[model samples]
Target: MADRNTPNRPRQRIIERGIELLLALCGSISLLTTLGILGVLVWDSVAFFQDVSILDFLTDTQWTPLFADKHFGILPLLSGTFLTTLIALLVALPLGLLIACYLSEYVRPAVRNVLKPLLELLAAIPTIVYGYFALTFVTPLLQHLIPGLAGFNALSPGLVMGFMLLPLVSSLSEDAMQAVPSGLREGAAALGATRMQTAWRVIIPAAFSGVMVSVILAISRAIGETMIVAVAAGQQPRLTLNPLVPVETITTYIVQVSQGDVAQGSLEYNTIFAVGLSLFLLAFGLNTVGYFLNRRYREHYD
Candidate 1:
């Protein structure tokens, strides 16, 4: 009996070791894939800069890669991207914060359970559908109301993008607000504070850092979004601040160039990488600021 048990124990140990090794290998492969993508992007962007001077790429405002006067000023694209993102944030931030506040403090539990999932469903909807809606429904509505709006202006697309980002901001901000200790609310109430007063003065201030992180995350998502902008926003890359006119964004440019007959190894191909690098840097910087804000400003009530 002892001999049989000893052999079985050894086999069991071997099986456990094999499972552990498999999981470790899988994790390593995932890490390698992420690192590989980053490596390729960096390498391609560096190669692009080698052919085109960094100064020209950064400072030139016109983005005519196919014409005889091929200039690659990335600023117009950057400005368009920023402008749209700013508009989206302006529309999303207040609505998202109010939703977060409602869910965290004001709503009944039954209502919250029903509504939260429905709101999150908005996030799960495919961006292509949003793009189509923007093109068909939103643009016409804007044109009817504003009279001077184009068939494809920045306002409709930006507003739709804001709607898309609202769930993310609200869900994250709600979680942060909910994480505030109940004792704080109780203390405020004990001190004769109303529910709204406690929420606005104590809860929101305590959760400000996390709320800011959510807002930044929404902005990042707005910046990286491609499909809605590609389908709804026009392909004209201008440096104007007029939101009513047609404008091209960085992501839209990438989609336009990738879909068209732009030859590989040409200046146009390199311009894609240059624009992509700028986007990557912008996202990286926003994420870095979010990290610092989370670290430095979060008020721990424990």
Candidate 2:
């Protein structure tokens, strides 16, 4: 019996080691792939900057990368990206927070179980489908409501992106609200505080950090989004703050350049990398802030 047990133990150890080795190999492969992409982006962007001055790339108001007389100022694209993302966040945050409050504090348990999954299903839809919906459905609706709105302006696309990001913000916020202790709500009720008052004044303040992180994450998604902006927003890069006009974004520009016939070694080809680097930096900054806020102010209900 002892000899049999010894043999089985070795076999089990071999299987466990095999699983560990496989997991490590897979992790290393994923990390290397990510690093390779970043390295390539940096390499191409460096080539672009070597040919063009950093000041011109950053401050120039025009983006005429495809023109015979090219000016590679990236500010317009950056501004457009920010404008749309800001609009998206403005629409998403309030609606999402309200939905979260309803889900966490007001809804019956049976209703919540069904509604939560349905709401989360929004996140599972393809972004390209959302893009098409923006172009066809949302743009026309805006044209009816807001006269003088262009066919491919920032408002429709931004609004659609807001809808797309709503589920993310709502679900995360709901989780945070639910994390608030039941005792607090009971104590507030005992003091004659209404449910609405407790939710708005007491619970929301406690969950503000988590909700802020969720909002930041939604902003990052809006910024990185490609298909909706590309399909709905026009490809004209301009320095304009008006949401009613057609504006190009960094993601849209990247898509445009990638689909063109530019040579791999030319400035136009390398410009894609430059824009991508800017986007990467923007996302990284937002994520860093979100991470620190979550760590510093996350509530411990227990």
The prediction achieving the highest lDDT against the true structure is 2
Worst lDDT run of 10 residues, candidate 1, spans: 293-302
Candidate 2 RMSD to the real structure: 2.2
Cα lDDT of model 1 by residue, 84-200, tens digit: 888899989999998999999999989999999999999999999998999999999889899799887888899999999989999999999999999999999999999889988
Error of 1 at 184 (Å): 0.8
- Over 143-190, each residue of candidate 2 has an lDDT whose tens digit, in order, gives 999999999999888988998898999999999889888988999999
Candidate 2 has an lDDT of 0.91
- Model 1 residue 270 lDDT score: 67
Runs of candidate 2 exceeding 4 Å displacement: 1-4, 7-14, 26-30, 299-302
Per-model TM-score versus the true fold:
0.91, 0.91
How well does candidate 2 match the true structure in TM-score terms?
Answer: 0.91
Which clashing pairs does model 2 show? none
Cα displacement (angstroms), candidate 2, residue 280, comes to 1.0
